[model samples]
Structure formats: C-alpha cells, structure tokens
Target: MGWNPFRRAPLLHVANDVGSGPVVVFIHGIASSSITWTNVIPLLAPGHRCITIDLLGFGGSPAPLDAQYTLPEHVAALARTIRSLRLREPFVLVGHSMGGLIAPRYAARHPGGCGGSCS
Candidate 1:
C-alpha cells in the first residue's frame, strides 16, 4: 500500500493504505471524520484496503467559507476524492447519516459500487 492525496477546492484529506485485495471507501456523517470508522478499520484492514475521509468542513479537511454545504456539494466532494485517489477498481461505499445519502448518489453516478442509506 502507498500514500495518496485527494483535494478539491477547500477540502483536502488523507486515505489510509491497507490490505491486499479490493478497496472499500467509507464516508462519515456530517460533523464526523475519518476517525469515526477507527473501530471498523482494524477489522477490515487485513482483507480489504479501507479509505476513511473527513468530509469537507469536518476534522482534518477544510471547508469553503463561501460555499454552501448542500447534498450535491457533498456528493461531488466524495466523487472528487475517489477520482483524486485514482481508485479505478470496483469498491464498496459505506456511509452514515447524511453520508448515507451522498454515498448512494456517488455509487449511482459510478456504477459497480454499492451504497445504502443508514440511520
């Protein structure tokens, strides 16, 4: 595994490099960051490469003061992060809360990925 950077406008963050097989990107809810999945990462890291990012305006990622934090903005941010990381292979997306909505939109825009809503 190697280091990769993802940046878009006011957002910038890191994705962990782990495992040997496919990749699984996890998006945390509004007000949360990559560390939100800390407990789950250890379990999944051995088998699948996992990515957990701080959404723009949260945690380590920066936010645009002039921009609106809408659903579409989040979806676009997630997509940008994925592409910036150059993750071309099929991957699974797990998101929580508002992220649940953003993840499905991303998967819909980019097929072969799975995403669902959660409380």
Candidate 2:
C-alpha cells in the first residue's frame, strides 16, 4: 500500500515507512519508542519493509497528559495503527519484551489475520 499517515485517539505519533516489501511492524517495549529498533532495522530492511512506531507517551509520540499506560490502551493504539496502515495482507509482527504480551493480545483480537511467534 502507498504511504499513509494515521493516528488513534489517545495516541500521538506518526508511523513512518522505511524500505519496501512485506510489512514488518515492530512494537517496542514499555518505556521505549520506535527508535529503539534503529540498530536492527538495517538488517531486516533487505527482506521486508519495517515500520517502527512510538507508542503513546513515549519517544516522538504523544501520550495523554493524564493517561495511565495500560495493556488495553496500548493494544487499542496498536490495532488502530495496523488498520490505518491498511495491512489487509497478513504481515509478520515482531514485538520485544513487554511487546511480547501486547502483540499476542492484538493477534488474538484479530484472529488468523495475525500470527505471533514469540520467544
């Protein structure tokens, strides 16, 4: 799909596009942002288009001034990002640390559309 920008309520950040191929979205750990994957993007760039994003309240992304970082909130933001990106085709999702939990929840909510192979 072409590059498109989107934002969900309570989340304030733009998901940037890098490279081109099958989409690979990375969800960072708690307290971290998309930049956390800077070191690894190059390695994956050759095979897939990687999209790293800052979750609400972290990195360049904006967080609710009075919002608490809860699992549900994080998952909601993630779902919106995926839909907005229009990744109708099944894409590989890589999550790290706390992302491990959040990613699975997202996959579960979306069913066969997403698959999680966590460590």
Candidate 3:
C-alpha cells in the first residue's frame, strides 16, 4: 500500500487495524509504534480485532517540531480516532508506558466507550 505523505497532515497519526473478533486496541509508548504489538497480535488476532494507534510525535505518526505533545492533546486525538472508528461494541484498551498513563485517563473520560483496560 503506497501512500502520499506530501499532502498529509504534518502530524499524521495512524492506526493499523486487523483481524475480526472482540476489539482490542493497543496504544504504544512515546518511543514505540504499532509494531510494538507485532509479537503479541498474532497470538490474540484469532480472537480479537486488533487496532494499534501511532500517537503524535511517534511511530508512523508525525512529530511536527512545532506541535505540543501534551497528554490532553494526545488523549483528544485518540478520542477523535476512536469516535471516527465508530466502534459500537465497547473495546478493551491496552497501552504501554506513556501510553499506559493515557489509557486510564481516556477510559475515565469516555466511560461509555472503553469496556475495560489492561495496562
């Protein structure tokens, strides 16, 4: 799949979605990408819909030098993506490190969205 980054947002965030079953979303730390779940996804893919996100300033996502990487901003971007995905069934969110820190706060703010958390 070839993509044109030229016309894309400077801080283009990405989410790799795969498989089909109960949803399980993974958010990696500031230092990682969706690749972080490469090992674990295969094990769980058969039974879960895995969606891993690349937060701002990390991974496949952009890290605009001018962008302010605040926790709230990151959370908001995540919330927007989740809403855009329109996942009707509540999902299990698993975040690592900084991502781990964001998960709980996100779950609390969007209580109706995240079914549970495994950080």
Q: State the displacement of the C-alpha of residue 7, model 1, in Å, after optimal TM-score superposition.
A: 13
List ranges where model 3 is wrong by over 4 Å. Answer: 1-12, 114-119
How far off is residue 101 in model 1, in Å? 1.1
lDDT of 3: 0.75
Assess every candidate by TM-score.
Answer: 0.80, 0.79, 0.80
Q: Compose the digit string of candidate 3's lDDT tens values, residues 47-109.
A: 889998898777777666555677766776677667767787888999999999889988988
> Model 2, residue 96: displacement in angstroms?
1.0
Best by lDDT: 3
- Which of 2 and 3 is ahead in lDDT? 3
lDDT of each structure?
A: 0.71, 0.72, 0.75
Give the worst 10-residue stretch by lDDT in candidate 3: 1-10
Clashing pairs in 3: none
TM-score, candidate number 1: 0.80
lDDT of 2 by residue, 1-119 (tens): 32123434454365556787887888888878887798989998888888887786788876665556677777777776666676646777788888888888888887755323221
Residue pairs in collision within model 2: 57-63
Better of 1 and 2 by TM-score: 1
Tens digit per residue, CA lDDT, model 1, 42-73: 99988998888788778777677655777667
Shift in Å, residue 99, candidate 1: 1.2
